[model samples]
Target: MSLANVFSIAGSGMSAQSIRLNATSSNIANAETVSSSIDETYRARYPVFAHAMNDAQEEGSLFEDQPKAVGAGVQVMGVVESQEALQARYDPNHPMANEEGYVYYPNVNVVEQMADMISASRSFQTNVDVLNTAKSMMQKVLTLGQ
Candidate 1:
């Protein structure tokens, strides 16, 4: 594979990580939200990713065997909500309390959300590092031509 392809791969990784970080941030932001009903509570969201394999081969092109066309990257499939049950809090005096004197809270676990945030942040940093490394390697390659 050409050194140029490294940039493309790393760039895709960075983009995917950015999306993950955004979703994690959104989940954390809504973690403490309360609702009078389960339908109103915010559920935790997570980004799904898939491997973006080179599709040139599937396209059945004559140049399929070339490594230039084999570059793989990461793809964000979609965001999915957690299916965990909502937390039921007994708060007779709470404004959002239901007729049964119970308020519904999001099932978002604060600790887990924080951990996911950290992991996503770290993954983003790692992708940035990958891009930086690819850039340095590309620069070195250019120097060889000079």
Candidate 2:
């Protein structure tokens, strides 16, 4: 793939990682939130990602002049709420407690969310590094003629 394609790939990766970070932060923020009902409680969210391919490359061309099939980039499928069971606590004094003196809390694991945040941050930084390295390589290529 050309250096130009590297930019597109890295940019898409960065976007995906950004979404991941957002979801992790949101999950962490709502980790301790209490709700009276399960339906009202916030659920941990995770971003779904899939590999994207060049659509044009998938179609067979009549001539051989067409570029070979290449990966487009990472695609964010969507954000999905975790299906894990919510935490139920018995707290009669809580304002949000239900009639049974129970309060519903999200199943978000703060430790897990913290780890995910770090991973997303590192991935984002790696993508940025990829972009910078690609830019530097392109610049070096231009200077090769001198």
- On lDDT, the candidate that comes out on top is 2
Residue-wise C-alpha lDDT for candidate 2, range 1-146, written one tens digit per residue: 56799999999999999999999999999999999999999999999999998745344667767656568899999999999999999999999999999999999999999999999999999999999999999999999999
Off by over 4 Å in 2: 55-68
Model 2 Cα displacement at 45 (Å)?
0.3
TM-score of candidate 2 to 2 decimals: 0.90
- Per-prediction TM-score: 0.85, 0.90
Total backbone clashes of candidate 1, pairs 3 or more residues apart or in separate chains: 0
Candidate 1: stretches off by over 4 Å: 56-71
